[model samples]
Target: MTQGRSIRLFLVDGAPNGLLTAEIMNWTGHVLTGPRSKLSELVQRPECGRTGIYFLVGTDPDGDLRPLVYIGESDDVATRLKQHNRPEEKGGKDFWEKVCLVTRKDQNLTKAHVKFLESLLIQNAGAMGRCKLSNGTAHEYIGLPESDRADMAFFMEQIRTVLPVLGLDFLRGIGRPSSNQQPEPFTPTQPETYPLAGAENPRLKMEVKKHNIVAFAQELDGEFVVLEGSLARGEWIDLKHNYRHLYKQLCDEGVLVDDGNGFKTFVRDYGFTSPSPAAAVVAGRAANGRFDWKIEATGQSYADWQDQQVSAAAAQSEEMEPT
Candidate 1:
């Protein structure tokens, strides 16, 4: 044959949840018939089209992996290799290392599959997606090598085999199944309520503490203020709307008082400022500020307030939707 043919093989082990897997992969290797060797030689040759290998670990956009780790392709193989092996150097974590350890200890995986995996990993450099195997968890990109098509075929086969193992072994940190459904539309019970005009919920509960603070300072205080936190932790905006308009409203209403260096709120007379201690506290207490604070006039939660805004926006959009 003048041109080498592509060969792909796949095997899945265990039940509905795969315990193990294996595959036979051959791509674009020059036709050679000596003891099935020269595989290494084929890998070395650039013309053979060994395009390298990569692993795509499935993850949410936020970079959390839950289900399967996919091995595939790359252009800068050296960088990809370092990315997988050196945890701290590459984002302080390495998922490939974890999977390899498990595979090493568990002989359930086949020799061919193992070789495919080992070569695929050793050859590639950077990894795409989350590395749950690593201590720190986040999605990342890997640099792959340029070689031949054969390597690509081999790596893809290995990936196919390994994916089944995730389901069977019940890997904890693997990303959710690729087939998992997207979230349904969010429907709120009430949408007409707004947050307390101003409140600072600064108890620091970890979940929505920052949001509460922003809600309090921006929505309630009606001021344009920038809050700085720990450097790496970054900053957050309390109010989602236009800070300048809110600031103008507060200034025009005389609710914001300039105190030499910066500004503070005189919320008692201002309708925009929250009536409570902080926005965080209000958010934590109830979804709707009106109901949570017992502000009988609104009879709604912060969530309800959000819903009302969304509904109004949607209505406006519909009216403007080319009718």
Candidate 2:
């Protein structure tokens, strides 16, 4: 079972969108995040002078849904951030609109420690494919002592845990079964099938007979994940629809690859904010995902299944309450 964690968040300026700091109980790591416009104020904070890693995040200028991110580490993050905030003519990056800094409250992080963190973060972010990384080449750092390496690994895990609470999920990988639900062993022979094992959230299938596309998806951790090896329409037919651009972006990113016929295959599991976009991508047109995605076991639509779950939960809650 996963243990519960206590996290404290403080809004520095007492404004929800203003500068903020986050810390976890019994953890030395600290996170400070704010918009680009607050660079002057953010740099003035004492933590900015410490050795740490920082992330610059913003939307892709090309209008892709995935944000553009650049990760860097510095002995003096304040100075480095100042350089990054300069005019583009001075080799500064103008694409990023928000900055998140990760430092330690104890101020024990060293140059070598942050370098290792930066490299590992870059590698994980690249592997996750949740954002478009602005980093050109990830530097290798192998000089840390064995014990320090272990400490840094724990630090990285804390960063991963804290980041999502701050609305930064680029490092969050594809969804997995919840703690109470254990995944069934995967069979290579049945590449297209995902065993449900009577789980509450069953695997859903979306089929477009006209396009000969078959896709599999599941809801995990509140995100709809289109499993790898699922098939989607080779060409997006709804040109004027907003989701067409998303389909094109996925194709460009190689998440969807041509299968040599009239369909594209998902190279890896990809998470979407909701099922509508997932359905739209697989069907090659705008689709009502709640109606289109059906439970493989009972042929119930996602909407119906979701409704049943909600009703059951409400009834259970009422039964548990005092008269």
Candidate 3:
């Protein structure tokens, strides 16, 4: 369980897109954010003179729509930022567009402290798989005193809590079930149903079954999750589509395995950007998942269910209006 956090953000230059400063309630750490265009102005801030860890964030065109980041730490963050902000031809980088740095408000963070923070951060970000890391080397562990280590760990915890609020979430771990967890724990055997928490609504949930093939799907957090044990078509018709690559990647990654019959069976849960793509890869051709999926309990189509939900919401809104 995670406790709540109180983060105070100051929008420097009084604009959201410009420089920004943030700090957690009762925390000694300070976070500063700004665009590369304003790096010169931001570097002048006092926190930039302190030893700290920083992230250079930008998008990677070849990375399948993932953000790219270069993580580094320096005794004088401002000087390092100045060097990086120079042209790539001049011992600088060319990819970053925004900068975010974390430092101690009291300017007491040391090289060893930031080094440990950098190594742990890189490892966790790599595990998250949400971004393309530009860092070519990892920092070796700089062992800290047991007491200072505990304090740094808590500092990292606060950094994690505030990162997502700043529109960065590369450190969030993907949802994965444990090894002993059943693939179809919600429903098993013939006519299996993969129930997801808060997804009981027919409009947003359904199971696809064709002959002996069965699959379950639900929308969560803007992504479609296909539960384990879901069967996919053994072959694909649109080989050039992006979903085809995705299917291949899933198979290569061992998330999907051959069923020994003529279809693909999911060994673990997987997430897709949308329902149609998920259904297409699962059905081996172009498919409209909105119409193909049906509620196991009522046999209602997702499209119809969605219409009913919209109508119900409008009616409720009308009822609540003052006459």
Question: Relative to the true structure, how large is the alpha-carbon lDDT of every model?
Answer: 0.31, 0.87, 0.75
Q: After superposing candidate 1, which stretches have Cα over 4 Å from the reference? A: 1-116, 122-126, 133-323
Query: Which residue window of length 10 is worst by lDDT in model 3?
Result: 185-194
TM-scores for candidates 1 onward, in order: 0.20, 0.92, 0.72
Ranking by TM-score: 2, 3, 1
Candidate 2 residue runs with Cα over 4 Å from true position: 177-198
Over 1-323, each residue of candidate 2 has an lDDT whose tens digit, in order, gives 33699999999999999999999999999999999999999999999999999999998887878999999999999999999988889989899999999999999999999998888888878877788999987887889998998898789878978999999998765665344555342221221222332357688999998767889999866689888899998889898899998999899999999998868999888889999999999988899999999998889999999999999999999999999
| Deviation (Å) of 61 in candidate 1 | 21
Quote model 2's TM-score.
0.92
**Pick by lDDT: 1 or 2, better one:** 2
Clashing pairs in 3: none
lDDT score for candidate 1 against the true structure = 0.31
Q: In candidate 1, what residue range of length 10 has the lowest lDDT sum?
A: 224-233
lDDT of candidate 2 at residue 117, scale 0 to 100: 89
Name the candidate, 1 or 2, with the larger TM-score value.
2
